[model samples]
Target: MMSEALRIAETFPGYSREDWAAMVEKALKGQPISRLTTKTVDGTEISPIFERAVGKAPLAMRPQDTTWAVCQRMDHPDAAKANDQVLNDLMNGVNMISIAFAGSAAARGFGLAAEKDVLAKALNEVLMDLIAFRLEAGAAGDAAAKAFSDVVADKGADAASVKVSFGLDPIGCFASTGALPADWAATLVSTIKDLKAKGFKGPFITVDARPYHDAGATDAQELGAVLATIVAYWRALEDAGFEASEALGMIDVVLCVEADQFASLAKMRAMRHLWALLLESAGVDFLPLTIHAESSWAMMTRLDPYVNILRETTACFAAGVGGADSVCIVPHTIALGLPTSHDRRISRNLQTMLLEESNLYRVTDPAAGSGYVESLTEETGSIAWALFQQVEKAGGAVEALKKGLLVDAIAKSNEVRGKLVATRRAALTGASAFPNIDEKDVEVEAVAPIALAVPAAGESCTPLKAMRVSEPYEALRAAAKAAGNPPIFFANMGRIADFTARATWTKNFFEAGGIRSLSDKGYNEAAEAVADFKASGASIAAIVGPDGLYEEKGADFAKALKEAGAKMVYIAGRPKDIMEALSAAGVDSFAFESCDVLAELIKIHDVLGIAPVAKAEA
Candidate 1:
């Protein structure tokens, strides 16, 4: 049967039986497989060999000890309430705060308020005292930088404890801005030096590869861009008078985490190994890289917003298990408009719940044992390392960037991926798979855009684009809650040859409703079997082998079953004459392999309100 199935599948061209067999073989080998069959990042043949030995090394970090934070970007229009939300989040277990400041306007609600003194004062009052503040790339703008300096200057070198990131890449900024300032490199070098001098250890000079990933670049392209960029940073810092080790020490790396669990997991592990090698090659001991991941903004969709919860959960879990030091979940409604306080809370809680409940962080290097994961990790590391070497040969990362080689590589990868997405080969659930036209009806707080306007003392201003209420996942949770726990049951049968297959099918049907299935051995008395089913609350029953028993006691047994008040009796392969004779016995149906038997059984169940006990047909 299996061979025939394979042959038909190979010839059908509709579905590959080889694919199915590969998956089945994998399942047989012990690793659980999802029903969906999608290609891995490397575009290699599918195999199911998972490693069970990779977790030997204690992971440097664990999510169980530290939960990912639920941070809202406080670029809101109002600085103070953005501050208020920060305090609220901290009080509710949100431990990290990240701010994105492009200018005075961007920093206003972040407490910059266009006045360096006031901004510093507000930041110290809100974030310094309440939560860990993560400074985004633009947060290092002259005004914002000075504001940060003032806040930490008083604290001196101990200011290292204050978390901050400078998304400093003159090239990245130039790419976004469409032109590089003549002194951009000078400014980045100076920023790193100044921040280091002020005792900011691990002050991030981002190798922001998210843009490539978001743009649909393959894993290799994304890693390549980052390697190239890191080389640029290394050279930039060394030229600015920092020793190689000091320069390497002055910066930390950040990578994006995606929903593809194994790919994301392998990518992170491979990255760590690569960073260690890179630092070794540069003759510097590698430092602990700090990766703060946000749910990919690019993957969110405007359609079928509810499915975003599933996406975010998967992404957040990936980020945490990928060993991210911190993670921020984007609200499901992000693509719709400005996020509300509730949206932020939900996003935060998503991380909170997963860490606390799922226990994903208890074990370190969770992907270590899987054959697929290890192989993929090695493959990614090799590809990325070769690319890094190539970049060094091409006058380094900056030159590669300037020549658009990295961009072109990403473009080619994106083109391949775009084709996959278009063909539904890469499923984006809400956007491409099952679209929802009805707007989600959750009551969520509306968030305005970040407002940097300074309000008069004691006055308040809302963030830009802030308004309304929306709760995208609330409805889903409510529905799930309402459904409650399903019931459980057991199936009992009387005969094997006569009713084995039918009993198995019936058991599966009932089990779908959470019922269990058990069959009576041949020695069990009919009455005893019925009694067992009754005791187990198995309201449904099947009587089997009446035809074979008829020469001896079939008639008497049917009469006894009727007298015993068996509600539904199924007679297996009863002769026509015997069935007629037994018609008055109230048998519900006579079962046989007519190919249509399964369908007929379904119809009977539907009409009789018989909820099957199992989810699958035996």
Candidate 2:
């Protein structure tokens, strides 16, 4: 087969970058190819095309065709209920479990309290030796780890037979909550000592990127933060009297996987590659780093939450193909409340199908040598390393955060990102974009939270808060829904061909905010549009048509709507030439692509007398 393929390959001529560029420019018709470039928040430009990658080695974590651990998160507050969930998931082919303790970010307000009794019940019938284990305990990490280790011993599970990530991440906890329970170095040393005495060979430290990622840090920022955090722990452990190789083995990583498949895939690959580079630069031997990816909390939507299913699937594929040791799919309904078993089942099945049915694990480092992914990996790593250097210059993750250097970077990125979401530049399907106004309420297991005592403040910086992209849009939708689904009169002014495109877009715009667009098919006369607007009884109105029609009748239509008692008149598609005339004729705003859609929606809501809806915090 190889000889025959090589014989055939010799018959064809190859294309060069110059040839590709000529074609691209011709297709662009005098427009610069730079117009196709997109940028990350860190200002890394991603080109639309690239030549074949050269001299790049594969960075896969596992061997070819090897399946990764299927980790189901155990987070129900009730111990008995959580036990059922764990056993159910395990019985159905899940090979790993991530235990989220109360007060952890992954728990999302509901997790088992780190008590021996609760731990015992949660793992009642499950054999610890049979499955992989992970722990997520924020500032209360020591207590949570101690409690879990003790429970395993009490059940007589041999420590050597079990594979567990202790997941004590003080830097990550402090970065998210702005407080460490104690001196992080002291805490890590004590925790390691206590666990070592119990015969537990450990991946004791975790450098989790979710805190920063959830706080709206871009991929480069999150990767940079993780790199700095891991360096901090490696040094701290060496200082506390561990061998360099042993200290390296004690660390693991967790990164958030969102809907951006190429970025997430590149991020995972870059993480492993970067880790190797970091360790080698410090004169340490390279080890294959263990990475765990969870679907992004920042991308989930409370409204039309099922879209998260699609988002998480794309995320899981990226995580798997990009060489994560394990991937956990956050339930689609998670943003709504505590997920039911059905929700959990759907997530598990989604992952199972990806692995078993879709065969995503059939190839290791699937993105290796691909031009776009390799370019992204290289650029992402280079940008991330520079940021890591910046954090190190500020002393470390803890000190950098304390100085608000990293925090300020996070804030700036978040501001730019928030503007993107508001302007519809970042289209959130089923949330900010094509939203379903009548989506049914999702079900969640109704359970009272296991309230846990928060640790007293150790040191404080400004805490990074988790934010969802759909939040502001959700608030607008909620307000509109509460006001009995307020109507927006569409004073469409043109023939069918002139108005159809803008009218369709205009309808979707208003409906995205839960406002019904009351529009006729087409009305050539201002009198007919005004008559329909007055009969529709909408306080806010929008005029939708082509530029030619807007140039002719736009101002006259705006004047008619205002005279018909429309509180605000909006013109769809900006006709810049007639803007002054429309404004004088009472056109309050212009709605167009890349405009501040959220702000315009809010303004319309104000005219409708709908009170501002307070957003629910994550």
Candidate 3:
């Protein structure tokens, strides 16, 4: 058999893979150093994750052959415009539709215009056979309750296999509006009972945990919130004289899967396992759970809005691999304003591409059975399960919510996450670093959060409204342009072994940090390099070559560069007398093999305050 085939055979050998892993670890660990190490918020020791970390879980589920529905969100100021958007998105591979209210007027407009009966009739009439519906009960006030039930019943009349999830919870409502009706729980219970009695097999009771996640809850905490919320519903149903199985059957949930692909993937898988465990503890057998995964709103950014596509893609991929029944990719332009019809179509298309072209939906539980993925699944599931149990023992999710324990735990997790961001352990692309200057401030008709009659309802939308500060583009651009022809110089003393790899790596490292390099083929002679540096007015020079060159020509090269008027020179490897020679030559800084070049570039950027600019037109 081929070597590739042999490697596969080796992985599934008769003995435990742990033995091989141990041997590999021993071989890999040739030396140990006292470097700073960090741990996850849950106190789990953070280690480099690879394919090897996955072990012994279900590798992939075969029946996940069908792609999930890509839902396009509609929240326009006008009903006809929103309806037109819904039609366009549905035609363009959007199998699901989520309607959100941008304002109280918007919700009222949708309610009054699409009038409970007319709206339900139109929704029932218009939604194509393949499309499902999600109603985000905005601040429609008294009209919300009737509109919700009417719409669900309308979908039911056609016997069309469409999903209808009404984000109807008194606590969620209270959180948004700070006005909870006295009959909030009673209303919800009645709605769930009504849906089930009407033979609606779709997830009738959606536990919206996105609020908790957007509020900065950890994955474990988010899962805990979901479970606790489910438990709250379970207790409420039981108090309403429902059986365990009935309550379990009525429960559905949505979770916020972030851009941290691996963690989010693990979180999704763990969610299923956690739900299974919760049901088992409740003396209920397996009941199918439907989970709708949304991209993390907290991680969305206004600057470099294009990067949001990358974020949403990974979030969608993670959700898909983690087995979410449905995944919603929010538009990149959503942060600026009410999303355009085009934006919604593109967002929906991302998932369509993943499923249809990328073949992501061909396998269920795709990350299963890997040593690392399985380990993460087990670990995350176990931790979340424990938290769920704690929440249940505290008299369920509602009690925890009422007493503020759930919020308190989430606050603690957010604090840790905040510290991680502050300390640079967790870097937010485009926002924390690599900010965009030419970017425009996004202005959109804001989606005023539906006020829930509860505490923390609007907390999820706070980050959305916060203004982001970035340096003015023209000023920064002018500064960068003024700095002009910022130096391109490389340091090499003489012919050296492995010159190719060293140069390639150095060039790559520099380019990755958004700096120009002065490397090219056939520039081998030190004199020629020095001449080019002089001709180009190079201010900084980097020496990347073998130690032999440093030994043979270090002193002479330093002396020559100094006489040639090079301001800063960096030597790749340590010379026999680098400090002495550089100090003698009056060089600004000397970097050895142990130096971190990226860190060095950051330092340079700080000192110069020189932003990057497009090369000036000749």
Candidate 4:
């Protein structure tokens, strides 16, 4: 009553940053503070503790409304079917529709046909004045824009009331497909003029950075690409006789929201900060940055498609809390095939639950003033701004791509990420860790194959390839499944306590590659284990035991399994001192913590006659 704030302030002494650090250090029991630091993929070191930001400008103003638009991607090839899906989505909860056009690089070979008839059919019952529409037409964006305009006119909707985005990103197309269908400058001029003539008020040109993000770019690199592309568009628009402010108003930013929730949230906030700073530098009055956040395709997996639900949920939450103007949650079964009605509904409802049930939309800039998030936002923004300057120095985004500078940088980051995935340093649930070998194939609608646009002659550049982190491991699983999920027998040496841990580890390890393990109970003798292994008809047998037991009997057990018809013998634990003896006695390899899981699985596949399918060179 004297005032709650005054009471709390009187009860506790204010703690300084150093004081907090001292307490954390003391709690660590003399461990270095650096031990608590985490290095992000972008090479930014994030400390565990952060003091309140001092003399730092807020990233962006809080949204006037707490809620964000629940956007859904509508990419079915059949326009009628797409329209049905759209109506269903809107009726359920979705307020925004992203129309992905066939042959758009962002569509990854799946989308509605880019025709006026198809556009009209897809938007047949959609209320243009109420719901938003975003077009992703890639190289054909200009054509698609005209078609959409025709549909709106035919629908008798007021053009000014319709919330639509042309989704024109020429640099994104070039980076994705290694070429542009038309000259970049010519395409931009024509598209901008057409939209301006139509009197469209929505952001017509989209500066999409998804190509970079899906290509395995770090947060800094993705943000840098967006900044560079935004600047490039501004310069182009000015050259095409548009005012700087008008050009800025015509553009929007689209970023990928991935499974790393905190990182995703930080990235969204950082991009807003970067854009505000860019506009401030240009002396343009602040215009609200329109951002469209979509769940990352690179994080989806075909092996365990259901896990993608959790991934997309976290992504949607991050986008909403991070202050995205709109958020699109990709269907969980997207990687398997064209998403079925059920798949789309589930994804859409998850967003609804987050907004309504969870009430995530009740706060604007939810992460604002949080020490860790603020620190991450600042660090991420600083790195991104520096990279943006590098692009400017190398001539803007187009020149950077033409010179292979952007592609090379992204490839380097991809190399690091690829290594992390292969070694299991980065865990992909149900793919790289705790995989379910008996997982049923996800059912999806049977749709026509995606049609990709062919690049025209004399229009070529280095393309940044998009890849999923689970592909390599998924390939290994597919190979094993193709081989009828061959069994790997585990020869448990000694009592249950002596071998259970290693046996479980070995079973999960093989199952991660889709190879089922028939694990036998404790075997006191090598002959008994050998008999069980032979009876199980397993081509591969793993010797599982504690280090002490391995030192004593691992060699004899490996030799026995080899004699009992095991094509290869694997040791579950890594006892370096006894490795030589076990190998000499017929142990083929050892699976242990920190080992290269992908490489080891491939080797096992080779020994079991499971030939992996050839992968195309990126």
Best model number under lDDT: 2
Return the lDDT, model 1, position 221: 60
| Clash statistics: count for each candidate | 49, 0, 29, 0
Error of 1 at 89 (Å): 1.1
Candidate 3 structure quality by residue, lDDT tens digits, 1-618: 477856876787574555645655666683322122346676555444344543355533224477776876666635566667777776688777776643322132222232465454335346434567766654442345456556655555543254566555554443334344556567667776665665555455677766666666678877887887777777777898989887777667778776789889888888888877777876777877888888876677655667888989999999888888788887776655566566666688889888888988887786776655666677777777777788778776655655566667777776676556543356546544454433455444444433222222322321211112221222233353356525447765445454666766565444323345675533445576678778765667776666566655655666667667776666655565556765575445554333444356555544555765652110
- Predicted structure 2: lDDT: 0.87
Kindly report which residue stretches of model 2 are placed more than 4 angstroms away from their true locations once superposed. Answer: 1-14, 448-453
Instruction: Name the runs in model 4 displaced over 4 angstroms.
Output: 1-33, 51-58, 455-458, 614-618
Kindly report which residue stretches of model 1 are placed more than 4 angstroms away from their true locations once superposed: 1-38, 41-44, 48-71, 103-118, 121-124, 127-130, 139-142, 153-161, 202-204, 440-618
Best by TM-score: 2
lDDT order of candidates, best first?
Answer: 2, 4, 3, 1
Candidate 4, residues 233-335, lDDT tens digits: the string is 8998898888988889999999999899999999999998998899899899888889989999999988778999999999998898898888898898878
Worst 10 residues of 1 by lDDT: 461-470
Q: Estimate each model's TM-score.
A: 0.63, 0.96, 0.67, 0.93
Per-residue error at 137 for model 1, in Å? 3.4
Tens-digit lDDT string for candidate 2 (340-363): 999999999998999989999988
Supply the TM-score for candidate 2: 0.96
List, residue by residue over 1-618, the lDDT tens digit for candidate 1: 377756754775553555766667686684445433345544643444343445445346544466555565664435565666666777776777766663422222232343455455445445453355666544245445556667667544256666666555544443333344556567777766676677666454766665556555566666776777777877877888878776766555556666677777777777777777877886787576666677766666554666777878888877777777778776776656656688777887887788787877676776666667777777887878877787778787656655666666655665565455543456555443343323355443354344322212221111112111111222222222233312222223345665566555444333322223445444235566556555654344455543455434545555556566555555555477677666666565665533233243344444445443321100
